[model samples]
Target: MYQFDKRIVMTLDAGGTNFVFSAIRSNEEIVEPITLPSNGNNLEKCLETMVTGFTAIKLKLPEAPVAISFAFPGPADYVNGIIGDLKNLPAFQGGVALGAFLRKHFGIPVFINNDGDLFAYGEALAGALPEVNRMLQEAGKNKVYKNLVGITLGTGFGGGVVRDGELFLGDNGAAAEVWVLRDKRQPVYGVEEGISIRAIKREYAQLSGDLRMLSPKDIFEIAEGKQAGNMVAARETFNHAGEVLGEAIASINAVVDGIVVIGGGIIAAYKYLIPAVMRELNGTLEMYEGTSVDRMEMKAFFLDDVADRDAFLVSTSRRIMVPGTTETIEYDSVKKMGVIMTRLGTSKAIAFGAYAFALNELDKC
Candidate 1:
């Protein structure tokens, strides 16, 4: 399904509830995306589902894909392509050698990384950090150095780090695993703790004595309307999580002057809880006169409108790497062709392609 003239890269972000996949050509061209239920029983089911998805993608491409990349949930051994134990995703425990399997089956290079790290990479490469840096430079401040952090408040807290414009994977690849803190200790000490959606639901059931909740979305909606007597508890829960996040950012700031690029479904309630978070952060960080903490300086990303900005960033990056080539041409042509693949959405496909592209690039090193 791939074309002789076009290159293909696949990326996937496997979550607890769902697995999102994308096949992109370069940074701009999206080749469609596939979504399937995430069965975490083991690597077998995941591999089966992925292979099937790849087959479907092949039908539309002109030739075999050039490379593959993945952004997997939980702790990932990116340097060696081995996955670590993930709590919610039962199937991924004891690690998965995803790269070796993909290579054996497809005869192509494959690269994989943590989902949180990919999000951070995208943000640092294209998101809030770039904008902030450009603004600072234009104002005549020595271009702010690249110490960055990205946090995702989804099924649980996910975090990643970047320093000097590159992803900083520590000696063990677990450098930014900040969400594993225990709830009681985290709340009191102002440290960020990762709270699963399931935990929130359990809390609601305990307080209201109703065990028939449909989804986190429904629960939050009702709580927002104050229809379920769940608003108080939900607000407390979110605020506590936000406080933890802010405290963590403060700790991170002590070490690096990086912007915190936040994303994920849980961040949807950002507006509701950011105030408390900001308050806690300010309380802790007020003494540091050099840290930037003003309203204009610290801005949260709105995923709705700021959507494909990451695509633009990635495209720009691809252009930078390939000098003398008109970047616009690559972006426009690839974006047009890739969007033609399907209707699933951009994030899935872009992540897939980006992952694939990353793997191919790493192989050269």
Candidate 2:
């Protein structure tokens, strides 16, 4: 591990509504953060705001920052540090060469990445995955988890994958864009249509037959109230959201089987969402059981007893013939996978992720 105590980097969390600035040490210590309105509609003002925030932090530092890193939203080129036209921040139209701009202005290396991807890297390196690995090691399980999927549920559903201790950006840097996957109910709509804050409001409205504007927090409050009808509606909304999320996760698992770490504002209602997600995952395991069987088959031995080998293979196969349907199905063996709330919270996780990512990049030089 790099010596984090001796390294500090300037960090920015360029959120949809706010531009939060801070400095983070490799040790995961965060300096005071300043939050400012994004002013996202005006590109000039947005750039100026970022420069001003970094300048102020630079003035307070005993030594100049080693590098600058940002956790930014994206549909653009993360590898090149460019930001595409963002729905929330219209000023970023036509894609901005943000990394080059920042590097030129600050005279230091600058790195930028999608917020969801950075969050996943942070949690895997310093948060949930590490905690889980420690516990498993202490329990003498001889297993350590190094792969994880991170999901953020807020204005939209965001996803990132970390495999074998490295962030998986895919060939085109659009690897974990889970939101675009088809929805279960309406194939025309993507997974985000059923899992985002808007989805919650839409579901709640349909359930209650009331179309009044309501935030997810407002819906959660109603669920906690004594009104039976509203409570059921609210619960059902979250339950459906969880089911959608679980389905998306299972699909991702087919490609990369690992624990999932969930974060963002909506996760505050995890108590209501998790059970529903687990229920969906339990029901949908059959869809991915083939992958699990393949893994188990890799361990099967030719020397095993004839009956024992057959029975073991049959159990792993999980194949069942459908009654009167000329169809067969496979069920998963209830593989141990975890879905847990993030321990680092959102902001700190992003900050630490920025710091860690900068260090890794700088090391290459």
**C-alpha lDDT of candidate 2 relative to the true structure:** 0.77
Best by TM-score: 2
Kindly give the stretch of ten consecutive residues in candidate 1 with the minimal lDDT sum. Answer: 335-344
lDDT (C-alpha, whole model) for all candidates: 0.58, 0.77
lDDT of 2 by residue, 204-254 (tens): 999999677888888888888933348889988898888788777777766
lDDT of 2 at 174: 88
Quality of model 1 by C-alpha lDDT: 0.58
For candidate 1, lDDT tens digit of each residue in 120-197? 666665555656666446655453646667766556666677787667778987877767544542455313333446
